[model samples]
Structures are given as structure tokens and as C-alpha cells.
Target: MIKDFNEVIKSRRSVRFFLGKNIKTSIVKECIKNATLAPNSSNLQLWEFYHVINDEIKINISKSCFDQPAAKTANQFVVIVTRKDLWKNRRDFNLNFIMNKFKDLKDKKSRRKKKNAVNYYKFLIPTLYGNFLKISGLIKYLNVSILGLFRPMYRQVTSSDLRVVVHKSAALAAQNFMLSMRASGYDTCPMEGFDSVRVKKLLNLPGSAEINMIIGCGLRSEKGIYSEQFRVPFEEVYFEK
Candidate 1:
């Protein structure tokens, strides 16, 4: 087991080449379960993972990716998907969790806190997540922008903005999955080069769902490390508060 967190992080790389050795699907699934521990916006958890190991499915997916070496040669694959259309369902889930959790508490302060949280899921969430086309979002944006001129306001209200929110959450889950894989002595390469439309069809996903990233999974081959790792100087990207 990889006990050193630092080593696990440092050892992870986009492995484009993989050995022929087989990896246990159950291990990968456990890694995915670990992925659910990642933080997400609104606790909505608007992500899904598809573990693709079937040979026929893998071949088709690789073709959708233009047979890129990263995907074409990998032993297995995990497709991260964002389901923004399920906002209401997720909101309800949170609400249900809150209700069940707070139902037994008798303290007045706890009751007040529960009421506030209930209102958040019942009213505030619907206000933000309930939108049609871009019309509602555009109106909310203009209203919020004007309000912000006077006082602090939550500005990310547009439909596009919400889409980005879902994508960001999915990315967090993807990173969690990758790190967990690394901790398990597996290799991965996250790729967005695939035809998302075809990939979704192959997976039988609805049009409302979006493919966040496809991660190739296996043990690294001799040629896996294509080049020396490089990054911009820390001083260039770092900032002092």
C-alpha cells in the first residue's frame, strides 16, 4: 500500500503507454468509491463514473478518441460524466438527508438551524438551479450585477455558469479517482480528446449528461513517461495574500 501521500501525488503522471498485465476491476471500483469523498458544489454530487472494461466497448471508445495511444493501449477506462439536469433530484436528496437528520433533535437552536437549511434547499436552491434556456439566468445575472454594485452578491447564476460548476465538481471527483488509483500502484491518463457525442451514445447516456473526462487505467509501460516533467516556476504562479 502507498502510505506516503507525497509520493503518491508525485508518482502520478499521464501514462500513455501501459503494460499487458491485467488490473482488478474491483480495485478500480474501490478507487471510484474513494472518489465520492471529493468536495462538490452545493453537495449536489452531480457526477457519474463509467468503468469501461469490455473489449468491444473499449475498442469503440478508443475509436471515438481517434485511437489516441493514451486510450487505445490502456487496459481499462473510466468515463467521468456530469449530470447537470439532475439538480432537482440532488437537491431533494440533500433536503431529505437534512430532514431525517434533524427530525429527532428537540433543541430550539437546532430546530432553527434545521429550518434555515430546509429553506435553503426548498427556496434558495430552486431559485438558482431552476432556470430555462438562458433567459432566466440572464435576468438573474443583470439583477445580481446591479445588486452587487450596492452590496456583495453571489454572481455565478447563469446557465453556463452552472454548467461550469458541475464540470468543476466532476473534475474534483476525477482527480480523487486518479490519486486513489496512484495510491493503489496503478497508472492513469485523463483525456478529453474523444468525441463526447459518440462516447455518450456508446454508454447509453442521455443528451443532458456531459462527458467530463475519460481516464485510461493500467500499469505504465517502459515508454509511459514520454518526457521529463516540467512546470512553470512556483514564483510565477504563486501569490501572497
Candidate 2:
């Protein structure tokens, strides 16, 4: 399983151009499940993903994203939206898994302790407060900071460090989806350049929801154009533990 996953990771690439091939809903669902399994700040599952299959809606979104040809060409596209309310509360989906894992370990003891632990996390204010303090750094950096209180920050790090954290999480999810797609004989592109506000408006997003990036998925076409870009060597990009 590890070898297969590594192979998928190594073979996956950004496929900007695609063939007119429809992806099965099952595949999309599987990819989304994998994406939701991605790590998040405080186990807070702040992300909301939209799978756009309608041609008209896709066309409108494509225009909103500056008419990127790849956006329109994909058989299907996925938009990642981050909920502001959820971010403010610091509630991510992973937290539930974590709490449950701990609860299971505790359940081996007594029913009373198991119930107490679950209630403490599920309702107790102090437990939540403690959890908040533990992951406070993540909150301060991922929410309270970055993004000029004015616009969404993109590019390398820069001012939107918080947004970058969310983007990194979303990007990891997207990469996981892409690798799964590749393993299933599909293609994908992780696009960064886009107008976030315009995209939000086009998608009728909530005030708290932020549009991060779009992923184009489909089959590669014979006419697809791929640029020859060099990736940094391991020595230049990593350090031993």
C-alpha cells in the first residue's frame, strides 16, 4: 500500500489540459473522502468543497476565475471554500476523530469515565477552552493573522501566512485527490492564479466562506501542452531529522 501510494505521488503532475471525458461520481466521492481525511488546524474541519459538474456553472466559474482555459476544459472541477465562522470557532473535522480515538482508549476503563470524557469534549466549556489554548498558536497564525484585512493573500508566504496555512491544508487535500485521480487513470491541475472575491460572488459564497483554489480534473488530451520545468533537488529542498 505504501509503495502504491508513493508511486501515485511520484507520477502525479498538474495536467492543465484535458480530454472530454466524464468522471464517475464514485471517483469524486472517494477523492473527497480522502481530502476530508487531510490534516487541519486544531482538527477543525473548516473546509467546504464544491464539486461543479454543470457545464453552465462551470463556464460561469471559469470566467470568474479570469477565464482560465483549463478551468473550462476540465470534465469537472472542484472549488474549496473555507468557512469563516468555523475558523473563528476553530472547529475542524479532525478533532472529532482525535477526541473519539482518545475516548476509545478511555472507554476500556469504566462507562462513567468514558461518558465523562465524551461529555467534557462534546459539551464542557473548559475542555474546549483548554483545547483552544493548546492549539492557540495555530489559531493565532491561521486565523487572527495574515490576509490584509483587505484582500486574500496569494503567492509565496508574504503577508497572508494564515491563509497560506489554510491553502497548504487545502493543497494537501487537492494533491491527495490528484494522486488518487492519477492512480485511477485520470488527470488534474491545481491552479493558483484566480480572483478570490470574484469567485466567491460567482459561487454565491457566504460572507465567511473564502475561495482558495480550483482543481481541474479529467483525461489528458493529445493536444495538451506541458512545459518543461525543473524541480529542486532533494538536497536543496529538505533536511534530515
User: Best candidate per TM-score, number?
Assistant: 1
Off by over 4 Å in 1: 132-134
* lDDT value, residue 92 of candidate 1: 94
- Models 1 onward score TM values of 0.98, 0.69
Local accuracy of candidate 2 as per-residue lDDT tens digits, 83-105: 63465255434345546666546
Candidate 1 Cα lDDT to native? 0.93
- Model 1, range 17-84, lDDT digits (tens) per residue? 88988999999999999888899998999999999999999999999989999888899999999999
Per-model CA lDDT versus the true structure: 0.93, 0.68
The TM-score of candidate 2 is 0.69
| Sliding window of 10 residues with minimal summed lDDT for model 1 | 125-134
Rate residue 51 of model 2 by lDDT: 87
lDDT of 2 at 197: 80
Residue 26 shift from truth in candidate 1, angstroms:
0.3
